[model samples]
Target: MPALVVFDLDDTLLDHRGAERAALADVHRMHAAHLGHHGVGHVQDTYHAHNVPLWRDFGAGRITAADLKRLRSERVLHALEAHDLDPETFSRDYLARYAEHWRWADGALDAYRAVATRFPVGVLTNGFSEQQRAKFARLPEVEALAAFAVISDEVGVRKPDPRLFEHVLGLARGVLDRPALAPADVLYVGDSFHSDVEGGVGAGWRVAWLRGDDARAPEGAAVVEDWRALLDLLEIA
Candidate 1:
């Protein structure tokens, strides 16, 4: 077993996409007048188109989290012609709803329990501190099992920035009481190809890419389609 098993919270362990869709539905309902003739699907597609690239920029150190949040909201509202709504207010409201709608990915709780029992488990995710904490607070199962959860907003750096991964590794070593722990002893799992797999591999750790559909896995990285597959990869099942 690996000395440490680290996970990315969004999409990998938590159903962030589900939460986002539900939150967007809430936001759309709340702002139907401002949103004009656009349906929820249009809004979701427009928002995702604007959001995904900004998140990639965030992971690449090309933009700050605050900038990504503000810009994505501004761009999405612009695309939807929702000029009457304030982007900042919309973003805040959406995030609040998102926090409340937290859901676990399939088998997340079981995988977390299994991993936590066999190895020190931690979370390294790129997200707002307060929102992430709120989600964790709602899921006592995850909170109790995690040895650490390092958020980019709190760390002032995001992945695939090496600093965030290094910080998690250092904390994992200390928490696991393995002073000599090295990169090889860690296995990092996440859904994003750039942020999780590339970042973990760049940090000299083994990576398990939690991919769906027909996404290609990078060389030397494990690819799993679901939490059950991930558990199998970790030898937890």
Candidate 2:
């Protein structure tokens, strides 16, 4: 049995994509006139295209969190030709709106409760500290369920970095009261194949790829569609 179970906070346990779309739509509506001929869909697509690669850079330690936040909005507005808008202000407002729309993934709380009862459950996520903390603040149950939460900003390193996984494992050992806990004694669960599955496996921990659709499971990894399937895979009933 695993000594601890670590989860990714965003799309894995929370409906972050849903919240992101809603928040982006709100921003688009707020700036529809300034957006010129570009529709909200176009704006969202533009932002996503830039945001994904920036986040990848973030995970690789090539960019700071502040850089990702500021540049994403700046690039999106530039693409929309909205030079009059302040990128920093737009990023802050977008984050506030995103926090307001926080929603848990279906069965997230139930799964957390179940798994926490049997194993020390914690979070290992790549995100800005304040923004991620605001998200957790909105869902007190998730915070209560987690024994610890290791965030990239706080640690000065992001996911897919072995150091981040090692740090989380150390924290998990303390929280689970198992000083002898090794990588094999923990299960890392997340939605991303590259960051979560590949990262955890590289760190020598078992991984569950949550919400993977029609994707071949990597060797020794579990691909699950939802929290219920994840719980079932963990034999938590």
Candidate 3:
């Protein structure tokens, strides 16, 4: 049997990190209506300085999702002394506006589509369910291609954790009732060494690293620069 192919969402297939930055830039353009001209660079800088560290804390399991979403943007406004800004209102608004500005890398959808045709495909990523599912719906129609995954908040766990990896493969194997596959049959593809590679390796599945930086992992498997390169790595060409 051909292997089951799993993928990461953020930098792997959807260029989520890029999409987020672009969305922030777009949001800056729109926020001028309320925040005023001075508020532009002010809010932007404060947002980055405050939000990035909070997210890092979140990834390290140092914060709660409620705190992550509610406080991140709110703190930015607070730091900038924009006391009039309503945290809850603007956070939701920012989500919608961000999604609107979402963009995908070249050949991203086509690459996933091509892989989906020949093997069982699933998305194994770390993201908020509502947000990630929205992005998934937008491009590659990931939900249509892969019916199973372990999203961060949804799964009550994050990547680089072996149990979460085990959970994803187990679900993919139809383990909800009867097991249909084994760990060896799935190869998880992602951009993070700790999350994707370590998680998959620890869980006893194959791994493919979607390398963005010069970072290297000692584990033996495939590595590609981007989605299109997946074709070559999988020898689909």
Candidate 4:
């Protein structure tokens, strides 16, 4: 068995996309007068176009998280032709609404409980410290289950970076009180291919990919469609 089991936060354990979609609804309703004619789909599409690239910039260290938020809001507003609306207000409102809908991915909490009962569990996620930590505040149960919740912004390195994985593995050594821990003795569970699978394999750790489609998991890695599948992969079910 692996010495430690690490989990990704957004989309893997939490319903991040679900919350974002709900939040968009809130933003659309709040700015109905300005955004009514264009429709919610247009606003959502515009937002994602700017949002994805801005996040890449942020991850690459070309821009700050604040810059990502501001730029995405501004660009989305411009694309939707909501000229009179304030970007700052739009950004703030969206985030506030997003926070209101925090929820766990289906069966994630149960999976966590199962694995954590047998192995030390930690969190490795790429996000700002405050924003990511706030997610725990909304789900105190999840917070209590983790041995450590490491954020990229806090450690100065993001996912897909070998350094971040090295850092977390080192911390796991201390958490488990095992100085001889090796990367291969850890199992990383996440939903992203580029960030989680590539990064975990690069770090020499075992990986269980929570891919909910027909896409195959990379060679030598476990593929799972949901939390229940993860339990089967671990042979704990």
Report the lDDT tens digits of candidate 2 across residue range 1-237: 677888899987888888888888888777666764677778778878888999998777788767888889888889889898788877877887888889988888888889988887888888888878887888887778888887888998777888989998888777778899999888898988888988898899998888775556676577887787887888987
Instruction: Estimate the overall C-alpha local distance difference test score of candidate 4.
Output: 0.87
RMSD to the hidden true structure, all candidates: 2.0, 1.8, 3.4, 1.5
Error of 4 at 206 (Å): 1.6
Better of 2 and 3 by lDDT: 2
The TM-score-based order of candidates, best leading, equals 4, 2, 1, 3
Which has the greatest TM-score?
A: 4
Q: Indicate the worst ten consecutive residues by lDDT in candidate 2.
A: 211-220
In model 4, which range of ten residues has the least summed lDDT? 212-221
Q: List model 1 lDDT by residue over 97-201, tens digit each.
A: 888888888788878888888887888888878878887888777768888878888988888888888888788778878889998789998888878887888
Whole-model lDDT per candidate: 0.83, 0.83, 0.73, 0.87
Quote each prediction's TM-score: 0.90, 0.92, 0.80, 0.94
Q: Where does candidate 1 stray beyond 4 Å?
A: 212-215
After best superposition, candidate 3 residue 136: deviation in angstroms? 3.0
Please report the TM-score between candidate 3 and the true structure.
Answer: 0.80
Backbone clash tally for model 4?
A: 0
Give the local distance difference test score of model 2. 0.83
Clash tally, candidates in order: 0, 0, 0, 0
